[model samples]
Target: MALNETHDEYEQQDLKRNLSNRHLQLIAIGGAIGTGLFMGSGKTISLAGPSIVFIYMIIGCALFLVMRALGELLLSNLQYKSFIDFATDLIGPWAGYFVGWTYWLCWITVGIADLAAINNYLMFFNDGIAFTPVEGAMISIAAILFIMGLNLVTVKLFGEMEFWFAMIKIIAIVVLIAVGIWMVVTGFTNESGAVASFSNIWSHNGMFPQGWGGFLAGFQIAIFAFVGVELVGTTAAETKDPKINLPKAVNSIPIRIIIFYVLALLIVMSVTPWDQINPKVSPFVNLFSQAGIAAAAIIMNLVVLSSVMSSMNSGVFSTSRMLFGLAKEHQAPQALGKLSKASVPANGLYLSSVALLAGAALQYFVPDTVRAFTLATTLSTILFICVWVMIMISYMRYRKLRPELHEQSTFKLPGGVFTCWLVILFFIGTIYIMSLETDTFEALKVSPIWFIILIIGYFGFYKPRLKAVVDSKI
Candidate 1:
């Protein structure tokens, strides 16, 4: 339980701090944007109309506080490599075990969904290459292996890969926004005779086109878009200067949310009326095609493909690190803790890659890939809520048990303990909203079985082993 004991245990074979500030920054940016925004926003806009803007802002604000709490914790104890490590120390070992395993499951679920999405996107290229679902699954598997190889090389290589991936996303978004603005300014009219104008956002039925129920429905899908926003917290151990770089990355959340989510959606809705936006197609592709761009689908296809790759790459990096942390804590198999000569957790990476291959199989065998993806994404979102709540809970406990650390801390969470509770309440409200819908409710109902299994594993395995370790130390 002592800090020195934990520190000494990892001092000999800890992960190297090869992630510079730039890599940390883009990783944070890339994490905030994902395939969900690119492909799923069409549905959200259809459901919430213009009100989707408020939905994203609300979620973004709440998660910013969550990241602030995480930033404070990581800085308070340099020995704590990731939030999972400190969750085990500050809350209890069981907290570490549950959160670590659930987080791993979260990414695996996300990777599965991404694989399915990648397959769907590949279909857009059928006109040129004649790709099939089987080929899509095969390509997905190859991409997973490629990501695993990049992660195994060195931490810097992983950073560099994320950097370019993030750069591509940023450029695509910037271009989309600029093009939308130009269309509005020039009073351009598309082939359908619908003129581009800022008034399209509310010209259909005033902001709440689908009413309050529709706005509420947006939360279920929109939350999935923000799944990996906390990937920066997982990178704290490898960041060059945790105190400086961590805060810089965390504090920029608001700007990223505004420009990336709010403004981008605002432009999309302004160019194309909410009523005209197809729920099944990406708004980006729809707007580009409407503007008479011949290869709009192909261009958007490539952009969306890059977004999926970025998300899957992050999944590989995060789950591997979570497994590594669990192994170090004796919550997982010991072999997962071993690092290669390059100071990478090679075994853990391989384990995660092997698990991701299941996504390919699911895509190939499942006739209803979309339904399967929906369920997996919903389950992943539920577990992510649990992880974020535990972070807030851990912060509250830190303030009570370690007031001196709070007093001496350089980066204190803005609202302190009060905001932690508010964030928890916000997450609870989101879950309630999810339960009101049929499709999401199914996943919500099934998600508890994961926790039940984790609980049984804790009592059956982890608890006794942890007690013995403590007893031997005494």
Candidate 2:
């Protein structure tokens, strides 16, 4: 069955359900673990010291609540292609329109940011064989084409590629953990006379080494790490046996966080004192290099490279699917609703690629746009939190008006409406935390411009057109 196909479509125009349990599981894992763990963990550890472990757990738990709400909403009605669908049916058409376009832009900006990161990661191999600016741009273009090619082929190819990309990340972390355990148990000492041991976690100035200020500072970076955790919610339409697969994916989030995030960080700190970790360097790379692994830099660079590529791949798939959903609701241009023979949203993919192409051009021509790109990513993070809040809002409406549905739901969100409020408050608090940082604060000031644009577009454009569509049916 296709994602949004109805008997009215004659089975010719719908997203085919080619994704299996395997795809969903790995997609969930890939969404939960991002390149941030590899590239940004050092800064987080340096900021909060050993207490960073608790920070990840706290953020993980909050997002798991958000996922649980999303899972229950998705399973309640299989016709709900994504949260956008339910947001329309339960909240209002306005909610759907806002979330659909906002989510689409979220992925677009994140995709652009990923492209920039890819270019930098490629430059890491700039040894004797230096990559000229032209060569670097070519590499970035090739990467974009490669990911876009996978998306244009089949959804399964995207899933398979993500499975392997995620597998590499998992393997890298597992290897790091295993090696760290060996070093700790054997009391391996480094050149700095620091011995590897579990005691290293708190032995240095204790777990809350930097106190509450530093602990709060960690949230500013750590929240972005979990940006894509709700990504599995987007695949509900194409998932085979979503009831089994979706819950399994959502339920495993806590365990994945403990293993991939909490445990992985614990191992990194155990092997090296938190204070000694370099904020500018990757802890994963540093850990391997410390363990006497000569190819550690090469190996970790490849892993991070693949990690960014995986994100771009997922971004392409997500943005395209979002356009498809929007078109089905008549909120977007009809052309975007068209599907390829492979059941992929070709036009949506093309449009997203064009946006990314613009991003590449910016990188090549402007060259001093890191601040602009950072602002874009920060705004993306703010929009993601908005989407999550909308999901929770939709869930609350579902319980209020569709009480019978809630009664019949087997996989109910624990604490129900109360949990919804708690998650919403947590996100509001996160936005406040963002304001405390100079860089993120700038993004916050700029974010309202996006909503202002959305408001004008909705009233000035989409609403009247939607009204006409409804009037024509009468």
Candidate 3:
């Protein structure tokens, strides 16, 4: 069915059931492999040393629970377009209004930051690449435009690109881990022929090299690395067979977390020694170079570049889809939902690409203007949390409002209402943890202003006195 068809007609098509199993599986891993793992992990390792592994482990558990909860709810009801769609259906239209827009905002800002990071990483090849900022921004802008072109061509092509992009990181990580194990066994440490071995992990202050304080501090970087974990859910609308595919995705997510985060870090710190890690540089690149591996920096740069492109691609794809959904709900301009001959949301994709040019512009005011993007992302996080809570909340309301649906639902939350509250409290606790961090606190301190901007914009543009009507049969 064409997206341009009447709302009644479009809703009748199984938009929720189109995503395939392989697509879902790759997307789950692909989304998780953002530049953070490739570029951001170096900073995290410097802060906590060997203990960063433990920090990742803890985060993985919490995030696992969150994804599991999301899976149970999404599988239970194919009616949900995605979380924002579900939120609107279960909560009020207002919750969907807030979440859909906020998530779009998050992707835009994160896209900018990742693009900036990409430009900086590109400097590895030539220290004198460009300092005028325009040169760097131009490179990312060009990349974004290229990706925008690709995505508008077809959704399946975007999936294919993500699969390849993600594969590069996976291969890099696997090689690193394998090499690390060999280094450990061969006892190859210093150039003097002394073996490094696993002792590096505990050689300092016994794993918690900077004490518990450092371990806790590492969460600042660690949490952000996990930012796009929800990317799989966004693919729900276009997936080929979400029911089987989604569970495959949710189950494999934790395993990838173990390999990419825990094992990879354990290996890096094991051979290099925690104290020797440079915060300003990538530990992965640093390790291979120190070991005299050929073209270490080049390989690492290429891998990180793939990461940047993947993120840009995802940003373009996700933001457009959100706008498409919001348009359906009358929370955004209706034109955004209009599809092209290719069945792709073409306008939304182009608009998001244009939005990222501001990211290129962001290069000018950075270190200062960048704060705006940072706080924007925080509010973005808050907004995502709101949608997640709304998901559980919507489920509760669905149960009460339509008990018959609950009785026949195939994938209900296991513990019923009790688990729902537990997830809610878990969501609240994450916010509390954020409150304790000075930067996150500052970002959140200004979060209300963002909401004000959103609310004002919503009222001015998307507000409608007309009724929201969904056919019962759909």
Candidate 4:
């Protein structure tokens, strides 16, 4: 191995941070806005009642704080390509292995869920169309291939694709929110709710329509809305002008998504009332239908189509990077770090796609109308929270060990170390709340199995890894 500063077995840092401002901007939005919000809003609001507003706000706040911690760390040290890399370098190899793999799993599961959503959406217009699990699996794998192709062509092309995709989602949400507000102002009346107003929220079950019981229940559903928030940090390695733009993208996006989720859901609930909104029907579609637009379903299908694909694209991109980071540290297969001339980790992209092929198989062999998005999403949020927790812990140690780097930071998490501890506690409480949710509880019960494996793997292999790495260096 060349002992030159930049070269190890390969030029570990050969991949340049070439992504521009627009790419980072859209990529940030691409991660946060998904079709789930468009389609799942009605169901979540109905289940949690008018209290769903606070559900979005609360999770949004906690998630923003989590992003704050991430922003501070990424800005202070732009050498770290992604959050997982930061965890590995700061926390140790065990964390690198655990965070990288779990994060990849998180995206793989999300990709499958989005694939299922896409196929189901297609079914809406094709009334007689039938899809077996086999067909669904094929569609999902095909979607993965499409995303891999985009990523492999050029990161910018993938960013451009996401840029337009996020634009569609952004425009759709803005239009929906505006029309919803207009409906409220004009006193729009619907079959489900005679005269819509702020009172529509209270007319049925009130703000806590299901009582405090429902508000608490809303937490379970609300957590999933924060799924892609950390994705903002994933682009750090490729992000051009990361110190300046990365922070701005991370800080501004969470606020924008928060407003979109809370205000939009509140308006939708106000227009339709909690009881009238059907999660299955999609509130976006109902918004158009209630507005008497003949093409509401058409427009919503188009918006959600873009949204789902953008999310899948992001899942492919982020998970590949995590795998790439793992490989760099020798915590995973070195093959994962190999970059193609396009600067994409072609191996991880294709390998993760292979994992997603399992989805196609599952869909073909035994596709259920429900793959249990609620629970799977809940499990993901919990796992994602753990990654965020690790970020704070890693950052905490960084502050303790590298006080000199704090001055280099253009972006720092507001309030310093105390907030890190607070955020960690917030995560712990989130897990407690997960147990409170019956749907999420099943996931919580099973989640420990993953951590147990992590523990076993740590004791079993990680120690030897450090020795092997050192001996190799010698």
TM-score for all models, in order of appearance = 0.95, 0.93, 0.88, 0.93
List the global CA lDDT of all models. 0.87, 0.83, 0.73, 0.76
lDDT of 4 by residue, 366-430 (tens): 46534445655677777888888888898898888888887667677787899889888977987
RMSD of each: 2.7, 3.2, 3.8, 2.5
Clashing pairs in model 3? Answer: 18-239, 18-240, 19-239, 19-240, 19-241, 20-240, 187-195, 189-196
Better of 1 and 4 by TM-score: 1
User: What is the model-wide C-alpha lDDT for candidate 2?
Assistant: 0.83
lDDT ranking from best candidate downward: 1, 2, 4, 3
Could you tell which candidate, 3 or 4, scores higher by TM-score?
4
Model 4 Cα shift for residue 459 (angstroms): 4.2
Off by over 4 Å in 2: 1-12, 128-137, 361-376
Candidate 4 regions with alpha-carbon error over 4 angstroms: 1-7, 128-130, 459-462
Error of 3 at 472 (Å): 18
Per-residue CA lDDT of model 1 for 1-474, tens digit only, reads 553365355547889899999999999999999877987788889889999999999999998999999999999999988867889989998899988999999899899888877776666666534345577678778888888888899989989999999998898889889999999999888777778899998888899989999999999779999999999999988999889999999999999999999999999988888888987667887788788786765787788888899999899999989988998887877678878999989998999999998888877676355566677788889999999999999999999999999999988999899999889999999999999989899999988899899999999988877776677677
Instruction: Give the clashing pairs for model 1.
Output: none
For TM-score, the strongest prediction is 1
lDDT: the better of candidates 1 and 2: 1
lDDT of 4 at 243: 73
Better of 2 and 3 by lDDT: 2
